[model samples]
Target: MTPHMSRKTRIAGISLAAAALVAAGITAGTAGASTVQAPTADGSPLKLSASHRAELLRDASATKAQTAKELGLGSQEKLVVKDVIKDADGTTHTRYDRTYAGLPVLGGDMVVHTAKGGAIKSTTKSTKKSVKVASLTAKIAPAAAAQSAQGTVAKSLSAKKADAQAPKKVVWAASGTPVLAYDTVVKGVKKDGTPSRMHVITDADSGKKIFQYDDIRTGKGESEFSGSVDLGTSKEGSGFTLTDADRGGHKTLNLGNSESGEGKAFTDEDDKWGTGKPDDPQTAAVDAHYGAAETWDYYKKVQGRNGIKGDGKGATSRVHYGKNYVNAFWDDDCFCMSYGDGEGDKAPLTALDVAAHEMSHGVTAATANLTYSGESGGLNEGTSDIFGTSVEFYAKNDKDPGDYLIGEKININGDGKPLRYMDKPSRDGQSKDFWDSSTGGLDPHYSSGVANHFFYLLSEGSGPKEIGGVKYDSPTKDDKKVEGIGRDKAEKIWFKALTEYMTSNTDYKAAREATVKAATDLYKAGSPEVKGVEAAWDGVAVK
Candidate 1:
């Protein structure tokens, strides 16, 4: 085999035929289609078609006022429909964001499930109590709250300087009793050049810090990894630019080693982009561009999502961010994915899985809007890893075959080990392999292991196995065996739970409930799929 072919085999795995089959199956269902039909267990088509989605959204909007009233919310509270999903049996799940007295409620998000005849079946909420306060006025001034928020960021993040944005009045109800509060956002650069966006909630009456969480979702490694690959580009003037018009006009930009601002668009003369080497600037761009396209296709075809926001609008990818910056991140404010050159600018954190991982963060923000702290934060991170692996398998690129290992190619540790392992998360030495009382206390990345392990057991079962030339030994908490249910079903259940059932405050326990509910909706109660979901979570000690 040629050097290129040899590298491809080593990176993807040993079973070329198996990889091809997986890719072919995914392609057959999604290729050349705006939306693919997903059949429930009974062989009935789920209402994911564009027309059905539109109809569901319209119905949800029309009934928002009634839903608020039905839930016994305060007169000042109102519901705004965020997303709508319908199952095969005519059950509609409408997700909404609550607002009180025209101010957004931080954790007052919920999903209302209805039967075929418009009767409410059940409802899942982030908070149970009504959103009410003695007054909307804040005794603490916005300037004072902003100053306090900035101080927290500097002290907590150890940043040299922090700037705070004007505090916005909001209803704090994610935990404990409801209260009027000021939501302040503090911005600064961390010691490692990672941008810090700390969200601080302070009591309106007491002027005390009530809650704080960082908005930055960062991943360790990306593109000199995927050998030679195809990229979607558009012709501009006489040359082609790194933009995919077919997939929401997604474009790749060159940051030129700067730390801020929108970077310049990458343009090529012959449209033949990237070498296997990293010296060429376009090489990293090629990887980033290709990764974005593959991720877009994966969601569009596999999950029936149009884009990150489900609006058919493509997001931007910024490459070469900062000098020797060894991380990549998804910024909600920019609605873009940014990548940095690793260690010595020799390796770009633009690998396929890294791209998928960062972009998935955007998907989470647009969907459940899971708070980026504690158990919910772990779920947020885990959701990205699940989809990132799924997207890798879906791409089926021989150069980068799908494996359960994340950041395998980027060499983030310099010891040639992956950043995290899905099958056995504890291999990293810090991640938890099972859910526990202390899981929420770990960093979001490490805490995500519970969900990661659950997904691996759900898709590939427990015990020892080897696929794509990599060996994995997954163990259950109780030594109970869990049978595999295939990645397709596993990912479908997760996507459904994330988009339809899960709320902002969903923890490990809540995630278990959400996935079980999602499985029941897609495959009916007591079905093997539902059983598999339960068993998988059980194996991870979620119950």
Candidate 2:
């Protein structure tokens, strides 16, 4: 494979594919795309014509109303089967347009709708057949069906095959950190032709669903669904892979275990967002696709990193580590990442910026090795904050538009206020633009101020103006009119300094020096990067 030039985040937390690559010494950005071809679009048996879709939609309207009634909506739900899809993996996916009280309603969904269609064919006279199933769509190739299905129908595994010898990987949640226990899920008839056994390794923590296949009527079962997933039936040398599901190119998985059976967070695991979404892993998956792709493009097409670490490796994510685990973090034990669900209708923190933030953490780890304490630690946190905000601006999602405020829609504070404000760090009641040694004792999210201020100054020149929705104005201390070098140049300079010059023991002064070194490396000692680094820090009121 032609070597890619970039440092990329491992996909361990997001998909077993990225995780395995990191495990195999293929850092994120450097690993070139494999020659593996995509599966065929017509690979599965489930195909729906326009007429078939309309028929299902007609039936869906009435059944959804019944569902609404069951949910106590009382004959007020007007459902429209808006979409019916046969995913590339052969799973029948569906979506519905829901109207409540005859008002133009929203918040409907796309989901695995083909559970034998018991619910889609629902009627008041027959409660046994009705279901609240949703159908979805995915890009598939003809060969993809058989290729993806191979994981589920994978050749049998013996006790020897099931055993794995390696250092135990540790995972963190809100309540505590748990050692990763790997187990094989085997189900099927043995070679004796009795009940066959199919062995698949799992994280053994959440045992989340990875890939599935529908029992075929006459032939060997087809691969029903395949995508970058949190947990699955993959094995070395063969079987389903996240790469198998990467359709739009390099993909990312954002895990959050909630309604996961109920969107409930893991109580003992690190409450970060990454793995799977309890309410909807697909939504999380696709959304991550949007965010990760954007970040990848931001770095590659924009910042020039192959992935997170600039190694060209895809990133991984995990979510809902523990119940009510109201926090998130990243580390080297696993290149994978995750998120958590908030209270009520609130979802785990899967915003574009949040994903960007976690991915940025991977970038930070691979580069600066910045100690997560004191001013340097604050700078590390600030770097993530700034990049996270930049990525938000990158994706430009309408619902969650690019903004300087982190976790605004997540409602983490439960008071409708955002988690952190970049323009003015103090907006959240705790955060700083200037640094003091004591800032380390504060929340890393809070101590992150000095760096956050630095980034703000670098991007917009330490001022207050609204670029994307959430607004704030920053001020420089020394009456210095610091000019902006912009985020594009700042990211290049910060990341380079991080990976090439900064060390684990690097401090605040070291941070400055390393950035200067990076600036020198990128643009010759006194080029734009050098001047920009000086001016950006000055705007953050550092000078």
Candidate 3:
């Protein structure tokens, strides 16, 4: 079943309405509370306080129309405010999604930065070109587009019974020039029983395939990784349920080897749970529950994000997704994370990094909403990897110590190897270690190597180093030395970039600019941190 298949429209409306509420001095929960935190790295205050965010939103919403007109947007083009950020020096950056002639523009998202007095300072856009289509009429029927999309998915995945949903008209600007297109979602079950939600974009006028991507993001390989661990549970009747009240009521459910529907909630007579063995169903649940909590804490303490979507609401974690599924995924429709039992049901993909990796996808969806294809897709995956590694380090679990090696504990390769490496991504044989013209054409998992490598070099620097018993030897594409900026500052820069500067179609080059801008925002321009960001991108050949 395709979950939240038509979420784009809903998300757009919700964002606009939320902005309006903020503008009217009404906000969600304690989001409007006055709480200020010290700036990091001895830099200016980059953190947005509750009242500050509301004021920024109010100002942004009030000037939306004027800003669009000043930016030379078409008369029919409308801007919906998505987020607002403020600097201590009184500069404001507002992010928005564009709608042209009532149709969503895939790559028309942009960030408008203004000086203290409301004069435009600079702008960063996913596409610099204007968004205007000659006509809104589609010569091709939606049914034909859906059928064509289904055929593409069938050809790509070799599935027997792929079902197509009615295609919706959207302005496709992610690649080439802007054009009218049909966005079709095809649903089916992959060979391994994982639910498929392939998004295919076709030209509305000519019915030509434009772009496609799978919504079901997965992490390959699996192992019963998490050892004995503590779990947060709540009392129900005389027993305890695997529901964590401390962290947005996050709960773990048992799929019982099923492939569909909401699974049953795990309950125990005592508060204790799991034996660290896959034979017992509770073992996997224990890992999933613990992993979710760790990810939540990491985002809260490290990233200042209260929860996924920044709404302070918990998401469900489903364990034992399918029969020998061998993979895990996150579904926006369900707003939940699902895990599969590895081959033969002896190994589960509930490792710490895997859990953090999947959950970070939700965070990306909430913030940048990076298109899960092309360079943006690679950055999306890379973002998850970066935060997943960060969460692992923050947890500092002895059994699953943080390392640059991803999926190390899961043993997904079956040869006692990791799924990917950050220090040198090409160590996995399929990943690209540096950026090139053809990097965007590779699978996102492989293309993500560039970002993974950049983060490693930025955090640990080039050459050899050791941390927490894991050794790393990162190399620069340009054969230049880059001093480390430390992971704390590095993560902060990345979070700021992802939240404040990036848009849907931000490519590797755009990412470099966003991070530099983010570094400049958090640390003054010409600061060592800003220089370090530029050098790290250079080290990855993104320059």
Candidate 4:
């Protein structure tokens, strides 16, 4: 294998093959309409002051109808409450889904902000346009649209393993105009039995392929420091199964060393399973289960997010996929994460960071819904890496102390080397440490280096340093030194930017702006955190 290059399948997230399908959105600069005291630098829980009670109470009284009117959703449109989040300072961010004429409106989701006392603040929307459709009727037959979508997938795959289901009709507001469209999922096994999953949306009126995305994200993940963790198991008729009933019924399935098959649910006489070896399927399951559990805990405890979709639902995990497949992927269609055994089944890609990486993709989809191609795609991938690394640190497992090096444990290249480096991404040869116009032409994984570098610089600062017993040497394009803001504050800033300020089509420049705004919201406009954000972006040549 080439040094600093990965030969293993490295599919990490949903790949939006077509860029036009991304939701058009209005970018909100920051989220500080109602001022609240900033979080402590020590990462303590935010405490709302009693002084803000009046504002909080007033904002809490704002109804959905009022919110709809504030957002300019016409009478034909309806706002459905998805979630309501109250911060430590009694600030609220109410998320909602939109429907037009009783049909689901794609890209019409938005979040309404208000002060403690129900004083309407500002609105953040995936799309600024009103949800109004010209017609609900479809001229093209569903079958014809499915067939057309299949033809589009057949151009790349020889095997026919399309999802055996009918397509659903929905309004596609990704473009300026809302059009009735048919959404189809096509899947097939390649000559090597590797699977390909793609989502195809066709215009119902014209039968033209409107948008398509690849769901088979390939990559390898694993590590030894994760140690052991408690897993929630379900009791079957006579034994216990590897199903986490407490975490939205998340189950881990064994693929029996093949690429296809429903396989079997792992069960044992006692819940204490796995011998820490690939020879035992339960070993991988143990790691997978532990990783999923820890990831869920991290989001819930730290970010106050419920599950991957923030809907208190869990996605399944499949291990031992294929014959030494050397890759892992997350399938949104099935709402499951699948992992392959490394060469000779000696290594399973069930590491902690890998598990978090895959699950974080689902979170990105639910929140920013970032397009998985071009600059937006790079941000999407980088966002996963940031959260994945964050989850690793949050776990605080002796076996795997948090570090910025990605895939360090799995050694996908078989050379005992990490898959990617955040401190100096250019060390990977394929990844660029700084941004440039040509970045959009690179693969999302490689293009993601810019953001990864920025995050590292922001969290740890530029130049040589040691963190968590790991040594790192980070340099800047401008040859400038940056002071660290600490990971806790940095992650909070990034997460706020991603969830509140960013949109589906956010690029590198926009990401810089969003992070600056996020820092300002959390630490004030001229605080050190905001300055750190600007310095990190400048170090990455993103300005």
Best by lDDT: 1
Error of 3 at 121 (Å): 3.5
- Tens digit of lDDT per residue, candidate 3, span 124-210? 888978788889999999999999999999999887568999898999987788999999999988776778899999999999999
| Candidate 4 whole-model C-alpha lDDT, 0 to 1 | 0.70
Candidate 4, residues 228-325, lDDT tens digits: the string is 45667777756677777677777788988867666689877655677765666777887777778878887876776667866667889898888756
Q: List the residue pairs that clash in candidate 1.
A: 12-401, 13-468, 222-349, 222-350, 222-351, 223-350, 223-351
lDDT, candidate 4, at 79: 78
List the lowest-lDDT window of 10 residues for candidate 3: 18-27
RMSD of each: 6.8, 26.6, 9.6, 9.8
TM-scores for all candidates: the values are 0.90, 0.49, 0.88, 0.80
In candidate 3, stretches whose alpha carbon ends up further than 4 angstroms from where it belongs are 1-63, 86-92, 114-120, 221-228
- Once fitted onto the true fold, the runs of candidate 1 whose alpha carbons sit more than 4 angstroms away are 1-59, 222-224
Q: What is the C-alpha lDDT of each candidate?
A: 0.78, 0.43, 0.76, 0.70
Please tell me which model should have the higher lDDT, number 3 or number 4: 3
Instruction: Looking at model 4, report the run of 10 residues with the lowest lDDT sum.
Output: 18-27
User: What is the Cα-based TM-score of model 2?
Assistant: 0.49
Q: Among these predicted structures, which one has the highest TM-score?
A: 1
